[model samples]
Target: MQAVHTAATAPAPRFALRSSELPIGVVAEQLGLTLRAIRHYEEMGLIACGRGPKNVRTLGQSARARLAAIADLKALGLPISEIADLLGPDGACPDRLKARLRAQLEALDARRSAIAGYLSGL
Candidate 1:
């Protein structure tokens, strides 16, 4: 026998998240982070949230997207401080990022030269 599913019999989501919002747990799951990490991001002023029922933090979709970018930048080795500057309203991040890349390359070249000098002395 083929079982028919009814709307009333459907399982509800764990939270009553609205279309525009995502609960903090879900947001953290999406970003592959722990609740503590999500809260740290908020404390770092990199993202903002709203208080839901019982004062649980709820983040909107935009905030979630921003957090995703924060994750990506952090993965790319940018400290939270640098990520904040790149995400700031006044930031020209593409150009700023190019400059940062060039600086990193120069630093790496200097490190390489120092390593070569050390090896020559050995």
Candidate 2:
């Protein structure tokens, strides 16, 4: 007797692996960060990347967003640790992250006022 395989029992289709085609160096350049800085962020658990067949790091859109956020937070003087806390697994910005950013901005404003006052006294 011959066995019959049903169409409903067919295996699922495989997806093409398009995510591994991104280049790490190009991402770094686009984000205005050094390749070493990108690796450092990965080491700090701030960004994630996939390994290519040859063991090269392949960053995706999420990594690009994280890099952009890191650069923005650094510009705002939030420090690396705080920026890492604000960024999520997929680079989604949480609402509470704004509180920390606001606090940092207040501190920067106070510092700027103090510098201005000192300059006026000279």
Kindly report which residue stretches of model 1 are placed more than 4 angstroms away from their true locations once superposed: 1-16, 90-94, 101-122
lDDT score, residue 100, model 2?
A: 78
TM-score of each: 0.63, 0.72
Model-by-model lDDT, in order? 0.81, 0.77
The sequence of per-residue lDDT tens digits that candidate 1 reaches over residues 8-86 is 8877755565779978998889889889988998998888988776778999977888888788778877787888776
Q: List the residue pairs that clash in candidate 2.
A: none
What TM-score does candidate 2 reach? 0.72
- C-alpha lDDT of candidate 2 relative to the true structure: 0.77
> Candidate 2 at 61: error in angstroms?
1.2
What local lDDT does model 1 show for residue 51? 74
Whole-model lDDT for model 1 versus the true structure?
Answer: 0.81
Highest TM-score against the true fold, candidate: 2
Task: Point out the worst 10-residue segment of candidate 1 by lDDT.
Answer: 85-94
Each candidate's number of clashing pairs is 0, 0
Please write out the lDDT profile of model 2 over residues 1-122, one tens digit for every residue: 97676899766545323643477777878778888988998899888877664677878776777788888888777788878777666666777687777877788899999999999999
Best by lDDT: 1
